[model samples]
Each structure stands twice: as C-alpha cells, then as structure tokens.
Target: MNAPYADPSVTAKTVSARISPIGGLDVLSRNEVARLRGASGSGLHALLRRCALAVLTSGNISDDPRAILEQYPDFDIQVLQQDRGMKIELSNAPAQAFVDGQIIRGINELLVAVVRDIVYVSTQLEQIGFDLDASAALTQSVFEILRNARILKPQVDPNLVVCWGGHSISREEYDYTKLVGYQLGLRGLDICTGCGPGAMKGPMKGATISHAKQRRRHNRYIGITEPGIIAAESPNPIVNHLVIMPDIEKRLEAFVRLGHGIIVFPGGVGTAEEILYLLGILLHPDNASTPFPLIFTGPRQSAAYFEQIDRFLRLSLGDEVARHYQIVVDNPETVARMMIKGLEKVRHNRLDTKDAFFFNWALQIPLEFQQPFRPTHEAMRALQIYHERPRHELAADLRRAFSGIVAGNVKEEGIQAIEQHGPFAIDGDADIMRALDKLLQAFVDQHRMKLPGGTAYVPCYRVLSA
Candidate 1:
C-alpha cells in the first residue's frame, strides 16, 4: 500500500511493505542471502540497493544519477530468508510503484530481476571462474547470463531488432521512433533497446499497441542495461523482459549477440558509442561476411541530425564504413520492410552456418571491444584517435571516447570524477577533433546532452584539436 511521506527529512512519496518474488527470482541459498544483506565493502547490498531503487522508481524522468537516492534517502530493500523460499522487504519505497497496498506487478518483476542478476553474477559467474579478461570467455559469460535469464529462445526466428538511441531527444524524433516500432511490430518483429525513456521507450511503446492489434502473443520487448547506465536512466514500463549485464561492454555485446538487426535513432554521445561499437565489429575482416542489418532513421525535421552523424562517421572511420549501414529518412514502413529483408538474410546465413537463432555465435568480436573501459580522465586523454591506426582499431578508441563522455554526463562515478577534476581532455587528430567538437556542440545546442528537467548541461569533455 502507498503512504504519505511522514518524514520531514524525506521529500518523495513512499510506502513500506513486504513483497514476495513475482517472477524473475524464486529462491536463494542462505549464503546468497547473506551476501545480498551484507553491507560491508565486498557485500552486494549496495549494488542491490542502487539497482532495486532504480526499478522501484521506474518511469522517473531524471538523468541525474543521484536524484532518486537523494529524494528517498530512507528507501531500503532486504531479501528475507524463509522456509518457504524468500521474501523481499522494502522500507520507504517509491509510492508510485504500489497500488492499494500491493506492489505494481511489473515493478515487482523488475525488482526481482535486479536481485536475480545481482545474485547470479555474484554467485554464479564469479564462483565459476569465468575468465572475463578473454574475448571468447566474455562472450560465453554473456551467453550464460542470457540463458540464465531464459531470454534466449531456441525455436524463434531471427526477428529481434536492437534499437540504439538516446533517452534525450526531441518530441518529433521520439514520435518517429514509435512509428518505426509500430511498423516493425506489425511485421512480427520484436525490439530490444537500452531500456530507458525517450527513444528507448518510444519504440517499445509503439510496438505494444501494434502487437495487441495483430493479436501477437508472447511478443518480447527486451531491455538490456548495465549497472552504471541503469542508475541514471531507469527502465521504462514497456519492458517485459529486463536483463542487467555486469557492465556496458557486456550490455552492448548482449545486444549484438541476441538480436538479428539494429536500428539507430537520432541521439547523442551514447548512441554514437553504440554506432562505433557495432561498425567496428562489422568492419573486422573476420565479420565482413556477417549479414547484420543496420539502419539509421528519424523524422523529416531531424534529417540534419542524421546527416551530422553520417558526416562525423565518414570523417572518423572513412567513407567505406558507410557500407555497413543505410540511412533511411522519414519512412517507417520502408524501415520495417528493409529490416524484414535483412532478417531474411540473417536467417539464411544462420541456417547455412548452423548457428543458433537466439545467439550470433558466428560473429567475431575483438578483445578490445569486450574489455571494460573505465573511462577515467587519463584513459580518455590517452585514446589514439589519429588516422594512422587501423580503421577498426580507431573505431574502438572512438567508441571509448564517447563512452567517457556518457559516463561524465550521467553516471555517478563519472560525474563525481568530472566534478573533482575538470572535464576530460580529449585530443586526437586535428580533423577528427574538429569534427568531434562540432558534433558535440550540436548535441549541446539541441539540448540532447541531458533530459530537459535537469540543470543545464556542462560539457564533460574538451576536444583538443591540433
């Protein structure tokens, strides 16, 4: 049940209650429960608290990583062990997550997901000694996580389309995403995204309506995210299947490995990071024959946005990079149709290669792409962005550059670092730096750097052009 905020110290509405696991997790061992309840330095409680709070406060529209925590300081969650399995107790939880004293079913499921992933990653992966440092093992880790979550369906066809875009976007751009999603859903295609608001939510929202109209049953709206990103951008309501990977690298790998194709919407640095990450993988000599479909689309009014992205990409990765993706403007049906055709190619390729429909085992991802990038000030400054390097390698560093900016902009650790030390200093080739500056400046001008309700966006990085 919901309750009024009685504590003068606390400002947001809250409710205190005990909720049982709905779906995501059913039971936990005594040892697992102890780790979850442990509040010490090595314990999982802090991580659980952050992720669970994000799930409880889902649909909150704030990019500030600490907004929810600050607003509800008293909020706490604990996994209570019982002979009947386990029960979750919440103290001063978000009131919006409940209705008439019962937790919102969807929020409960997501909350359970937060716990499940935290426990699984801590107990299973780490205990199993998965060599996260190696590329193949990292891929195996991702596969195991997805399989544990029961997201990888064996009988399904190659119809999952991974949509990459920003949570901060224009109204028109957001609407365009919905339209494209509706078209995709009508054609029996599902969607997977970062699971935040704006572009992430729009596609899933549109797909729901179309799925209902077509009487589509068991349609999947998968949202894959990591701990750092989830803290800033909470999962949207439309996501029925939520999987929180260990980090952003695993999250990105989850997208490419699980989905059949990808669609890019107009977005800021985070979206750029995704684009470069994918293009880097596709550009690899080993993956040239892989038939992964990638398309960039937006409203007619936002054509210039995609044009800027196209220019920056060509300038940074060379014109040959354009062969990996197509830019389709203002046409939702065409995007869906093209995506359908692309999935056909993916299906045929998988059949010939004898690969599983749920996971793209045939695609080769480099170790550089799999490794976790800390995005520290030193790391950002040390990136080699000159044209002297191989194009794929250059793309990897470029992706890291944008990732650091994203961390500084919304992630708690990145923001703290940026506040303690000034903006990250990024210097590369003169031409690349200039283009990067122009693209970032355009993002700032368009108010695509952060959500509108937050404080004005101060750039988190400086482009040092030669």
Candidate 2:
C-alpha cells in the first residue's frame, strides 16, 4: 500500500489505520469515549490528536512543536467503544509508525499511554476538583497519576536514575551520555529520562545493549513527560514505560519522587530549571539532612559548560548551594560508580526514615516549587530575583525565570506569548543578571538554544540590567 500523500516541506509520508488498545487503557465508559471524541472548547479531542500524532511519530528528531501538525494537517483520531474494549481510529497518521499496513508494537503501546493519561487526568483527576493550591494535594495528584499508569512499583528497589539534558547537543556530549548510561546499565541500574532525543534518548539507547549483555530482565526505561513539551520532544523509541503528568511542575516532582538519584548532562535553560528546582527543595531547612545525590557531568570538551552552570548557580543562589551537588567531567565509570554509592546512601536514608522505596515521601517540596508557573510577560517580569531573600526562596524564583525562558524557547504557549509581546523581561541584581546574561549568551553561541537546522536562534527573554 502507498501513502495517501507526502508533503514536500516535511518530506514525510502518511497512512490511516485502526489499532486496538495495547498497554494501559482497558475499557472506557461510553461517556469517557464521548469526552475523548468531544470537539468543544473544553474537549480533549484536540489534545488527543496532537499527542496521539506525537506518539505515532515517535523517534522524530525535530524540536519544533508545530512541525508534525503542519506536516499531517488532516490527521485526526477517534475513540470507539466496543463490547470487548475500545479501538483507536487514526486518519492521515505518520507512515513511520506503521509497517506493512500494521502499526509498530511499541508505537501502539505508547499511543495507548497517551489515551490512558489524558482520560485519567481529565475525567478522574480534574472531575474530582483537586485543590491545586495545597502543596500536599498537588503531590498526591501526581502520585495518583503515576500509580494509575502503573509506574510506581511497591516491590521494586530504588534503581531508577533520572537523566536530564538538552534535546539539542553536540555529538561528543551525546556520546558521553550514552557511555554514562551504558556504565549504569552494566551495574544493573535502570534509566529514566524526559523521553526525548539527544541526551534523553542517548542514555536509554546505550543502556539497552549493556542490559542485554547483563541479561537484565524486566529492565525499566521510564520516560516521564508533560503535555506542553511532548510534541516538541517525542518519546524516544527505547522508552518501555511512559507516564504523562498534567504540567511541568508535576512532571518535575514526579522525577524527584520516583528516581533514586539524578544525573545532570549538558543542556540549555530547561536543564538549568531542573537543577534549580532540585537544589531549592534540598536547601529548605526541613530537607537539609536528606541525602539526594546529584551530579553534573559532561565530556572532557564540555568542561566549560558545567563551569558556566556552576558560576550561575553560585552567583544567583549563593556559594553555599554548591554543597548540594557534585561536578564530574570525562569519566563515565566514575560517574556510574558515584551514582551507585549515592543510591546506597539513599537506600539507607529511606530505611532510617521509613520512606517507601517507590516514592520519596520525606522530601519537603514547598508550594512555590509544586505550583504551576504560567510564563506570561507580566508574571516573568514580576519575579523577585534578589540576594536579600532566603537562599531557597531566591532559588525558587530563579528556577521560574529559567522555566520561563524554557517556555519561550520550545513550548507552544510560550512561543505564542513571545511573538505577541516580544521577549520576556527579567530584572534582578546587577551581578546575578550579568552572570545570567553571560550564561544564556553562551547557550546561544554554542547552539544550545535550539536544535541545528532550524532558523537562526533568537533570544526569547531580555535580561534587564539593574
């Protein structure tokens, strides 16, 4: 069979097919099915179409969120309620997701995850009217979503290592991520990432081979993501478990709660945001004694990248923040070894505190960290990046600042806001702002702001010198 059409701009082919539910979704009620098919302003149909298309085009390398939609303009999806279960009808979907007229098995499972998460969040979570204002409630909501997806295993030991890095990175840096992941897998450690390409994909790709050699059965490659960024960063093919949170805050929280430790690789503003989020939570007086292992590493050539990140963190949050994490360069074995030792401490801490291995209940995440931040111009400008405030509070606002830049860089809503209101305006103390400007400029100069082959990179936020 031939594709119905191939767009010259995207140079991609499309197909249409009906697939049975594979992984998470069982049997949705008729009302649930209708809500998924709904087309109203509040309906989930549009969200479903965009996400389902993203899943079908898994392993796509483009960073532009709208590229897939533009390529498959006529793509649509519908959920049909049947006696036994449900069926998904995909129209004008990406041809790569199918082979010889049948959808790829992995892709099929991911598509089911997309549906399962959407329905669970909208109908079950939202309909219950969760009090988003309360910190505990929000965390519980994240736990419920993950538990519903069967991502949280009570019997499993703490082996999941959450890897964070840029989707756009140099070949050398990417290979380094794989080497680190391969070492971790040889030690029987599992991998969890943001589920995109570049650094996110590299680790999982490398770990698969080592896992095969170790004969590690039921090895978990978890990909945790949110709705806003999934289209831009599709789930990499190696991800065996996929869980989608409702928003970025929850998404970050899910990572900290689920993974035993974290590995930081070379990345852009998004990576900085993750660093700040974790450090801020750890710096809180209540969590000061909690041992969460965090390491920043890259290839030998990328030493300066981590140096700039270290400078920015010290200048903005204070030199004391350095105590929270370590920096290791050009050593994959040492990185894995350190992470394994760190996990041992994490295990002992969990035991002493009586915390569940599946979840980190002892960590105190302030409301500021858990709350969803909307990166509108006004909100971005109003952030208080000052030195007088407490270190953790200052870290929270700084995290939001980088988070806004991330929104402007790749998120759809942030891009639209930037187009309408120009670059976001960030103001702070002169020294901190200067350090931030230099760091972001380095990202631009090194092509960390956007993936290669896109248009010339442009600044999305202006650092107003104080």
Candidate 3:
C-alpha cells in the first residue's frame, strides 16, 4: 500500500509527481480544473488541497490538526486538464506517498476518490435541488451521494458489517478487533469503519488475510469519513472504498443505513457519540421491530470497559435500551456467530418488509437525528440533557455533547473554539451530569480520548452538575 509512516526523524522531504488516474476519474470539465486550480477562498481549490494532503499522508497518525501541514508546509496539488482525460500535478507533496517517483496504487485510488467526491459534491449538489431541511430529502441526498460514489449495489445480500470504535485504543483492544473482524471475514462478511487508525484499521487488516484465505475476490474495505474529522483520523490504507460525506451527521447516517449489522469495540467519546446516535434512532417506536444486530465487544482485559459502557447506557437510557444491543465480550467467534445469526433475521425482515438489501430504507430515522448539530459553545450549554424529555430526545442531545468533546479533542475548529472561549460549559440534571462526567473520566484514564503517547488531554468542557 506504501502507506505513509510518520518517522520522527523525518525532517522534511517533498516530491513532485504527475499522477494518472487508475479508477473511474478519467475526465474533468474545464470549470472543474479551474475550480481545483482556483485560489479563491470561496472555491473548491482549498478543499482539494487539504483532502489531497490527507490522502498523501494516510497512515501518518497525529491528533494535532496542523501537525501534518506544519510538517509539509509547502505541499500543494493541482488538477491539469489533459487531452488524455486529466492529470494531477503534485508539488512539495509528502515524499512518503511516492515510491521510486511514482505514487502508490492504493493511495492514488484514494486520491482519485478524494477528487471524485469533492468535485461531484461541488457540481451536482451545491443548490442542485436537495432540500436539506426535510428528513426524507436529507436521506435522499445521502442516497444520491452514495449512488454517485457507486456505494449502493443492487441484488446483494446483507453481509456488510459496520464496525465502530475509537482511533485511540489499547494494543490488546486493537488486536481483539482484528480477531473479531477475521472471524466475520471467515463467514464471508465484509467490513466498514470510520476509516482511521487503531480499531478502525485493525479489522480491515485482519479481514484481508481471511478473505485471501477464503479466496474472497470482491471483498470491500469501505471507509466513511467527513472533512472535519479527516485531518485527525486520515483514511487508513486498507480502505479500498472511501466516501467523504458533507457532515458528521450524514456520515453517521451512512453507517447505519448502509450496514446490515454493527459491532462496537472499546472506545472513547467519539465511540460513545456513535453509540448514542444509533440507540436513539432505534429506540424510536417506529423502529422497535427493526432487526438491526448491534454488539459491543473487546478482549478479556477490556471487560471493565464494556461494563462501564453498559452501566452508562442503562443509567442514561434505561433497561429497555439494552434490548437494542448485545454485549459479547472476549469471544470473537461468538460475536461473529451472533452477528451472522442476526443477519439471517435481518434478511428475513428486509424480505418480509419489501425493503432493499443494500440500504435500510425501512428504518425510520427522525428529523432530529438527520439534522446537523453544530457544537458551538452556546449549543453545548443549550443542549437539554435532562430527563424531562423523551429518552430518544435526551439521547440526541447527549450524543451532541460527546460529539462536541470529540471536536475539542481533535477537530481543528473545536480546538480553536476551546482556545478562544475556554472550555464549553455543560449543565444538566445533577445525576445525568455526574454519570456523564464519570464516563468521560474513564475515557481519559484509559487514554481512550486521544491516541496514547501524545499530549495529555485537557478538559474541553466543564460539567456543571449543580
């Protein structure tokens, strides 16, 4: 894969290479080239540059948003409109992305995805008629984006499993995720993840060997990421299919809608946010009968992690919420067996309900889940995390709170906001706030909030439990 490794001794190195497309990114309009070449702040040129850099430094892990840019300050990319389709001209680009004056095949394919998605989103979407306000419209837009990316397949069985976990995790936990992934792969299930390091990358890595052993030719390693989080968690090397959604909300939606089942490994705030988001939607009365298989798993040593997670969920959402997921700790085979068994029910449900196998249209995702929640300071403080509302509603706001922490922890804008206005103030009912604080503290103690060996995490939000 020629994935970039962040060598601490790597002072500075750059490469200039003209890359031709390997995927379906053959042609680009004159306007598209101008858009990529344009220096205007309002144009797509800046976005292309940032995303291209991310692709070039795929496995070079760093939570510091500006670390990569600081390392290769002069990195640049341009789209040249050529007679033979199009060519990408790189200047002062990261040297690791290239080997012997040629870009890596996997990296180049991802680069093509970066170009393809950004351009398609620019031309086809920008006020092209997607009513983002309506839930159905938002879902339709997600559908369109996936369709354009060729993510949607017809007449396929339900086997794609969405694995969720933190980029920052322990070695044992990471290895455990791979074992579970390998087990699933042996049973012919493909993998999808947030597409970054740690748990996200481990499963795909393990599955590749199993798929090879089983002679599975068309195994898909899909990575779903958003621009805001991509800087912190760049797409891992194993991802053959990458889709960058417009926002985190859309990205989360893509995960739930696309996968037949989901497996959650031990993780931190971001993982908590994903858990809450899916649980909130599934708790909806309309989705009560949906046969979505959800599992929480990890190694034997990580048992306490799941215990804490289960306690938090029960405390926050109640005993009924536990029905939506099973806790399968330390047994990778059982986890796989349960998911495969559950998938059979999912297949039966989809067939009985007359729903498509590729996308889960039958699941009723409310407008609250679809709508984007910008984690501004005021928004954080304004979240109604108390128990006076419906469980699902509280879950939604709780998800937002954790999401805000994720932003502060890694996303550039979130970090900037914290530096400017101090930590976000989160006030809620006394018990809820305390429970929240406890869970967050556990994440910090376990080094789940950020990748271990980096800077110590400071509190990004003050929990006002009074």
lDDT of 3: 0.88
Task: Please report the TM-score between candidate 3 and the true structure.
Answer: 0.96
Worst 10 residues of 1 by lDDT: 1-10
Candidate 3 RMSD to the real structure:
3.1
- Give the TM-score of each candidate: 0.97, 0.97, 0.96
Clash number for candidate 1: 1
Clashing pairs in 2: none
Question: In model 1, where do residues sit more than 4 Å from their true spots?
Answer: 1-12, 39-41
Q: Name model 3 segments beyond 4 Å from true.
A: 1-12, 39-41
Better lDDT candidate (1, 3): 1
Please give, for residues 333-389, the per-residue lDDT of candidate 3 as tens digits.
999999999999999999999999999999999899889888999999999987788
lDDT of 3 at 323: 92
- List the lowest-lDDT window of 10 residues for candidate 2: 1-10
> Model 3, residue 204: what's the lDDT?
95
Candidate 1 TM-score, C-alpha based: 0.97
